[model samples]
Structure formats: C-alpha cells, structure tokens
Target: MTEEKIEQGTCLRCGRVATLHRGLCIDCFRKSSEIFTIPDYIDLTVCRSCGAQLKGKHWEYGGELKDIIEDEIHSSLQELSGVEVSLEDIEMRRGGEGLYHVEVRAVALFPGGGVIPTRKALTVRVKSSLCPRCSRIHGSYYEAIIQVRGSGKDLLRQEEAVDRVLERVDQIARGDPMTFVTKLVKVRGGWDIYVGRNQSARRIAQEMHRLYGGDYKVSSKLVSRREGRELKRFTYLVRLPPWRRGDYLLKDGTPHRIEGFQGRRVKLKNIETRREESVEISSVETLAHYPSKEVEMEATVLYTSEREIVIMDPVSFAEVNIKKPPGWKRRESVKVVRVDGGIYLL
Candidate 1:
C-alpha cells in the first residue's frame, strides 16, 4: 500500500502550498518580516567650540558632520538574526532648523538564501554644547607651568634663549591636541608658560636641556581632587647655562671660544694657542669667566701671511698684527673680536 505523505509547504499568512521560509512564502515573509529596526529620529551632541562630537561618553575630534552621522546610524540600527545589512549609499539634506533628513539605501542578505534591497529614512537633530577640553581651556585650566630662565649676564641673551623654547611649544601642540599653552607671563628674569598637559611640559624641558646645556627641576603640588582622585599641578624650572655657543670663555686668563656641547660638557677652542679643551657644563660657570670685554667688529685687512695677518683696528684705524685663524684666506674685510685687551681674527 502507498503511504500518504503529509504536505509541508503551506505559507501561514497566504495559505499557499509553495516553498516556505519560516512557515511563510517569500513574498509574505518579505512583507511581514523586518530585517532590522532603526529609530525614527536620533539626537547627536556636538561641541560648539571645536566641532567635536560626543559619542557615548567620550568626546572625539571626528572629521565632518556627515561622516559622524553615518557612524551614529550604524550604531543605532538593530538587526535580527540570520540577516546581514550594509548601507550602500546615504543622502543628507538640511530639513529646517538644526535638523537633517538622512536617507539610506541598504542591502540585506539572509544567511540561507535571499538578498533584499531596502531603504530607510530618519531625522538627525544636532545639539551644540561645550566639550570637556574646551570647557577647561576656556576657563584657563592648566596642569603644568614651565619657567624659562637663563643664567647669562646679558638680558638679550636670556631673551633669545627663552624665545626658542616658546617656538618649540607650538610644535609639540600639533601632534597632541590636549597639549596647549594657556598663558604666557613675563617675569622679572624670564618667561613663565602655563601648559595644558603635564607630559608636554616635560618634553619641552627635556629638549631645552639637551640642546643648550642646562639644569631643570620638576616639582608637583596637590591642586585638587575629583571623583576621589587627587589632582596635582607640576612646575618645571629650566635654567640655561651662563655661556652659550660662540661666546668667549676665560680659563685662567686665557681666552677660549665656546665651540659646542657634548653630553654634560662644553667644547672650547683656545683663541691664542688654538688648543681644544673640554670642561663639565656644571663647572664651566665657576671655572670660566664670560669675557665682559668681548666685542666683535669688522676690520680692514692690511696684509696676509701663512700664520699671521695684519689688520687696521676698527676703532683706532691703526694697523694691528694678529694671528690668522686656521683655513682663513686673504679677504678685504675680516671679522675680529676684542677680548681681554687683545684682538683676534674670527
């Protein structure tokens, strides 16, 4: 006897004996099933000061408003199981005050077999507010103070060194948005820079000490407390060396031009003997005296020889015999420096 087989392809909605998906025909399934759900509208928070967006609980410097809106929409959608949805295109138009109408064209793929083209529309409301960083910046908040001071006797020299450090601060801020200069206050001897981040201040101080020989000290003080965490403000005191490169240093009545620096020591070349010398940066301040009588001026060359050259003194216009510097040739005008009652060709 032939067994009567049970029929199993009836759609629950249309009662059609056909191929079924989840007990429903493809047409009925597509009509009744929603692959994903998106809200009718979404609210986005933006920083009015810097154009940053607030995602979840954090503030990010994302580019452009349209790109941010697309990201928000992706996070807002809820997809059902066995369905994968991808947005193919997005069209945005301004819809009256602070509202944007977003239209998304998407494709949904079912794991077993079907691909459905879909379209979604939603409204995006943009709300402007101040971000945390912008709030702190506007309020003049600072985490560190960099004090740039020089040990030189000349005020012009001190000012020049301090200006270099100030220029460096701008470079550091480019890579790190959180690091910024809040205020610059001119003090008696040098300038004080109030910085937004503590780590940035340390970088400035380290670079300063490395290029120009100097000493720096970092001190921290308890400033405040928030959320049961202690907040501390840091102070970096940077002192440049008394003598800079190219300055004349007097060692036991002998004049030496400060050539360069190597690690913790300074390199010097004797003006009279042409001998090279090295001295610790820490001890140079005491052992070498900054030639107060040092002055550089242009002189007229009267005669030239292998080891010696004659020049007309710039001040007195009288011929003066001086030792020619190494690799120096005959020139109409020569650079000469007066140090400790002696004239030497530079």
Candidate 2:
C-alpha cells in the first residue's frame, strides 16, 4: 500500500538484473547459500523396550533410530543461531566394511527470501541400552504373581487354559508397551506366572475370565511402610471353573452338561431332559474321574422315528435307542460316549 520501490541491480556471479543484496541477485545468492551445517560424528542412545531415544536432556518417545541419529548430528552442528532449518530427506546405510554413510537433505531460507536445498553427510554411531522399566523386568522385578489352579479333573483343563491365556497375552505384550511376563513356572496342580506390572497381571486375569469363565482373588503383601502408607507387592489367585462348557458332570444318576458358569454358581443342562438348572458351586463337587470327550465313538443313524431314534455304534456294533435329540436326521453320524455301562448321545 505504499509506493512501489524497485531497487534494480546486477548479480555478481551471473550478472542478472533484479533486486540484489551484497552485489548478487536473489537466484545467485540462493545458489551460493551456506546456512545448512552438521557435524561429522554423532552418538545416539536408543531404548530397547519402547524404541525411544534420549535427546540431550529429554527422552523422545516418538523417535526412530534413524531419525534420532539425524537429530543428534544436527544438534552438534555449528550453524547460524536463531535460524530455522527444514529437513527434507534423510538416509543411512553401510558404505564399506566398517563405515556407514548418513545423508541428510535440508533446505534453509536465504537473506532475500529464497529457499536453498543442501545435502550433508555424517558417520553413524549407535549405543543401545534398556530403559528403566525394561531394566527392572530383566532384573526379575515384578509386582504380582498370578497363580492358576484347579481341583480334580479341572486341574488339567486349567493348565490348558492357562497356556492359552499366556500365549494370547504374550502376543498382545509384543505390541503393548505396558505389559511383560517375567516367567511361567509349572507346579503340581497348575502354573505360576510372574508379571512385571500389576495392571498387566490384572489384564491377563480378565482375559481368562472372558475366554473361560472363572474367578480371581487378589492379596497384597506389605513390603515396606513410608509416611504411614504401605508399599506392597500383590498376588493374584485365579481359579478356573470345575466344569467347563459342554463338559458332562455326573451328579447322582444324571449326567448334566455344563452350559456355563456364573458368579459362585454353576449352570447345567440335563443331557436327556434338556432342563436347565443353576446350582451354587460350593454345593456341588466333580466326581473322582470322568471319561474324556476325546475318546467318544461315532454313531451312525440307521432308523429315525418321531417317538425314538435308533443309532448303531461303529466301534462296538451295538444299537442303542434313546429319545431323539433335537434336529435328528437319518443316515447321519453323531458323537456318543459310553457312560455307566450304557450308550448315550452327546
């Protein structure tokens, strides 16, 4: 909004006429820019647990190895103070047997409002170390121990479920920055899992409840007291259900299939009556031993009727007639088990 003031001059190197500073035009000045600078050698510290980098006095959690290396090199450089430089591209690769080449592309503003692109190189040197959290974990430092246990036949079942939960939690921990498992020890009845953090152990117990119905109890030990407050390490006792889903529990003269479990309650359905009942877990206990579902025999349907269905066991070549299972069909195979010296459909 003022008068147009055009200062015309000639470039020093190319002799072009335009707005000039220090006997040079904007284009020629930009071609001869010298603001970008970096050091020859840089040292970097990378965390193995979270892959974070320590920059000067602060730790940067969102930095990759290459990016941190470039930043360290840039920080050690002696460039014009109070000027902002933009990093365009950066790369690092091994050039020879013991040498690595680091190339950093950058752009800086010239005196006459021109952008100058400059590329620089530096040697890459790295030092790796564990952060505080990971170091604590490696030192067998844990806040809680999760004990998985079951009684009677459920002991084996609980072991399987614990293995599955450990596998799944380990998969999750590979990507989760907060979770880690220190060790898994096999005991007589079940397993004991040592966890690095309390939250991670709680999460594993929650997953056990979700995948397989169970209950957990937490107990804390007072290790030390500070200012009337106690510092404690915790232990979690996770008890799996006595009867899992689809498992048949022989109570009295009836074998009831377990539907699921509620809090302190066991849900069961009669295999023949199809009646459902929920009983308190304390009121019932599993039998000494029960035939496993894996050893069941295949039964082929030979005849079907509205009142009853006849099926032939291919293993023993015996035909057993029971009330038709819902959705019964002809010439179809069904898995059946031998219980109490009688054949039953499962």
Candidate 3:
C-alpha cells in the first residue's frame, strides 16, 4: 500500500494541520474572536399620544412601530472592523406591557471571505412619555396668534377671509404636527386664531398677504423667561383689502368690477367701457370701493342694436336701455350691473 501524506497548517493557537487563515484555522479564529457586540438591553421612548418615537433627543414621526424598533436595534449594535455585519431572522415577542424580548441572528462577513454567524437575545424596554410638542399642546401652549381681519363692508367677505385662514392652517398642519391651532376666538371685527407655533403663524400670514391682496404685520411681546432664554409671544395681523373678488369699484370716475387678483395685481372689468384690465394692486387702493349684493342682475332683452340694447330690469320690472358690448349678441336674457344710476350690459 502507498504511504498517505498528512497536510500541516499552522494555527496560531492549536497548531492544527488543516486550512489556515491569518496564522489560525477559520473555525478556531471564529470561536476565539468576537465578531460583533450588542447591548444586552436597550431602552426606547415613545410618545403615547402621537405615536412618535424618540430617536436620540428628537421625536421622529411617520413610520411603523416595528420599523422604528428595528432601527433602534441596529443603532445599538457594534460591529468589528473589516467585518460587514447584518441582522437576520429577527424575532420579537412581547414579554409584558412596555417590554419586548428579541432574538436575532447576526451574520458577520469577515475580510477576504469568511462568514461567522452569532445569535443574540436582548430585552427592549419601551417607555411611554409625552414628547415636547405634545406636552406643550396638551398644556394649551401657543406661541403666536393670527388675527384675520377684513376691511370689506360685507360681513360675508370677512367670513370668507376667515375661512381661507382656516383652510391654510389645515394645509400647513399636515406637514408639521406641531403646527396646530390651539383655539379660535371670535371677537369683534374679526376672528382670532391661536397657533401653537410661531413659524407656522408667520407663514400663514405671509400666504394670506400674497393671495388676498392684503397686508400683514407681525409684533412680539416678552412673555416669560425660562432656562436662561427669553420667551416671546408673536402676533400676526392679516388685514384684507376693502374690496374683494366680484365687488365693484370706481376707478377715475368710472365703475370697474373687481374680478380677481394676479400676483399683487388687481383684475378689473370696466362697467361702462366693457373693458377688462389689470392694474397694480396699489393703484386699486386709490379707487372708491363699491360693494353691493345687487350689483349683478339678469334682465330680459327687449331690443338689441349695434351699440345699444334695451332690457327689462329683473327687480324694477321697467325697460332700461344700456350700451351693449362690442360683440354683444341678441339673447333672451342679458347680464347687467347697476353702475351709478345707469344699467350696463356685460
């Protein structure tokens, strides 16, 4: 029989004769060395009300609870250098209220090609606490107040302005949970909106000024001092213009109906000339504001001519002759607006 030859490899510890890796067998190195380390127990705090998780010093929102816990687990794990480690087959069981027992298999990929698997069991203690924002909100804390006041003569227009403020608040609150309305107080002349955050209140005021052809002013007052910092309460005053959309105004002795706003410009439709024009918002401020609920009337067309049309007033039931628009067509009914003492066809 031929003599069999035995392979010899130097293992740093056992002097084994087999495959050697870094002066040691792979199995012996794995058994003797530490692949990774993880804490035996981890603590995670959560907001009881908003379901927000506490990460470090801030509250994080908008994720599944299980995913947040997994992140916490990953954050607590420490891996060896040159070893790509990952967790697999993570199993979690609720031991009791605010307690979680977790079992996970960690796979460490060593440099140059070796895999070491380790299993660990850890306890996660879930602590429930009120986050900073939620705590302030529960205490009815407000940093700013938005005062929505309308200068228009119509109370309906003022109410509409208030409604716009409310809609804007709802939209802004969707992004930031801290941006909330603490209370809405209806006072004389307008509505007062108490906001939880000053930044959100300022944004709402600026948006109202941009869209509604109005102006806003901000003021602050020293409320108190805490933690060696001054706490100031802010107030945002949003004032709507005297004329709103669809109202009529007299520009340079001519009647013009307010159509709408376009980026700080006022769109107007001249009642007498039957012309549509856009002018600077500041220029409209010089015009005489005329707001009337009965400005628009549907009249029965009695006669039609090239430059004139006769119609029966819907309210007075009397024949009224008015200048027709350039492309005015003969129709049974015509839309007219009462300008000064004359009826004009639109």
Candidate 4:
C-alpha cells in the first residue's frame, strides 16, 4: 500500500499554511484570541459582521482605516488637553483587504486659550487594516500639517514653525505611545514682530543672543517712510551683531527708537557742556579748528546719484559735493571705527 500524505490548511490572517491545526489556523487563532489593552477612559467597540475589533461607538465600514486611526489620535489629544479637536472635511480612500488611505485634519489648542487665533491643521495619509479575527496593523504613506506657531511676522515663519513641530512629533511618535506624528503640507500665514522700535529691537536681539548665543540672527528693516520737502526723511537700517539681545519698543504699533542714523547729518555735542550741539550753526568757517570744547561726532553719510554711500565730516561735506576726493572714487569699502559717535569712511 502507498503511504498517504497529510493535507495542509492556510491561516486566514497571515495566509501561512497551518502546521498542526485544521479549520482555523494557529496564526489566526492567536490573532483572534489576543486581547487589546486600552486605557480605562478610552471607548472601544467591535465589528458586528465577523466579530472583528473596532474603536469608538460610531465605527462604520467602507471608510478608510487611516481615517479611523486619525480619529483615535484626535481623541487621545482631546483626552490629554481636555479640548475638542475640530476636523476639516476631506475625502478618504481605502485599499486592499485591510489597508486604507485618508486625509485627516486637526488643530492643537494652547493652554488657557481657546484655540490659537490662527487655525492650525494637519493632513495625514496612512494605510491600516484589521483582520477578520480583529488583529490591527498600520503603516503611514505620507503625513503632514499645514500650519504652526512661530515668532516671525510672515508666512515663512509659520511654515518653519510647523516643520519644527512636526519633526518633534515624529520623534515622539516613534518613541512613545502617548505621542502621535503628522506631516505638514501647508502653512496658513506669517508671524508678526512683537517688538517694533530700535530699543525694543536691541532688547529682543540681546535677549535672543543671550539665550541662543551665536546660533541665531536678529535684525530689523524699515518698511515705509513719510518725508516732507523741507525735512528730507530717509529710512535707517539697524543690524545687531549675532548673539546680542535687547528689547525693541513699539510706537503706535510701529518699531521706533532704533539705533543707527539715516541721512547726511552729524550728531555732535559740546565737549565742555556735554550737551547736544544745535543743527543751526551760524557759519561753516567758524568750525575751522578742533575746539578745546570739541564734542565727538560721527561722519555724515552722503548718497551719490548712483546710490553709493560716502562718509565725510561736516567740514569736508562742501568739498565732497563740489569735487569727489581722488581716492574716494576708487574706494569700494566702508571703514567703521569703534569710538563713540565714531566715523565710517565709505
């Protein structure tokens, strides 16, 4: 008589051929029998069709599993912060037997505040499934958020902040169960400078430098100017050294009292009196020699028709206007001195 071979059956869960059991396979057995441990307050439900597991009481089929996972994450966030997360409307797709694809929307709330003034949103597409026996598995294809908070006053700032937050989220999600991850695909808007004046700018720059050291850049620029015909107004640019910190005060919502000067005027003082010299000088020839009561002054900066900057003293101002200095024509660099009210030769 010929020896008979045993027929093998396959597991419905993993599709691996069964070794010892019949009907339902061992892999399927473990998956079906395994219990999912959830937190005490987390609400969970089960699929009625094949006794498969489901989460939340409102579970429905045909919806993407990724959407379900995102809902779970949002629920967890709500539990942590005690705030409800609003989800934006989006389309979801499902693939394979247990796989799903979806775009999810959610906002993060700050402590003691109703959501942030700007709405922050995250979009995620993930693939996940639950076996007929209730085994759960998930994989993310792409995930990101479109907005995040920052200290800048423009769209780029918000985008940068969102990138930073999502990167941190990714790290947490990969390491801890309490954390979740998402990708940022869009940012809503930009940041506004909280401090607007020169003093405020200095303070802000100083503080940032003190905290972050040489790792950051803090500077300010003039956005607009209103000049009268008699008083020619010019915009000033102040650049703080890297790693300095100070506050920039605001005036009527605009930055003022900033360091540095603009235009062709020298700031002078009476050496003996230690007081500011008035701009109404009687005559140019009266300023012939360095007075014993000389007050230090910075060089006046003049702009050429071509917008080139030239630095000279009040005495040489007329000469420079009439005839450009021989060496000055070939000079392309500005010499900055370190003295108080110092000179800058351009």
Question: TM-score of predicted model 1?
Answer: 0.64
Candidates in order, TM-scores: namely: 0.64, 0.71, 0.63, 0.20
Once fitted onto the true fold, the runs of candidate 4 whose alpha carbons sit more than 4 angstroms away are: 1-147, 150-152, 182-346
Clashes of each: 0, 0, 0, 35
Query: In model 1, how many backbone clashes occur?
Result: 0
Task: List, residue by residue over 97-193, the lDDT tens digit for candidate 2.
Answer: 4346888888765444556677888886666777665777778877778888776566668778778767866776666644567788888778888
Order the numbered candidates by lDDT, best leading.
1, 3, 2, 4
TM-score of 2: 0.71
- Per lDDT, the best of the predicted structures is 1
RMSD of 3: 8.1
Q: lDDT, candidate 4, residue 105? A: 43
Worst 10 residues of 3 by lDDT: 1-10
Which pairs clash in the backbone of model 3? none
Q: Which model, 1 or 3, shows the larger TM-score?
A: 1
Model 2 score (lDDT): 0.70
Candidate 3: residue 114 lDDT (0-100) = 67
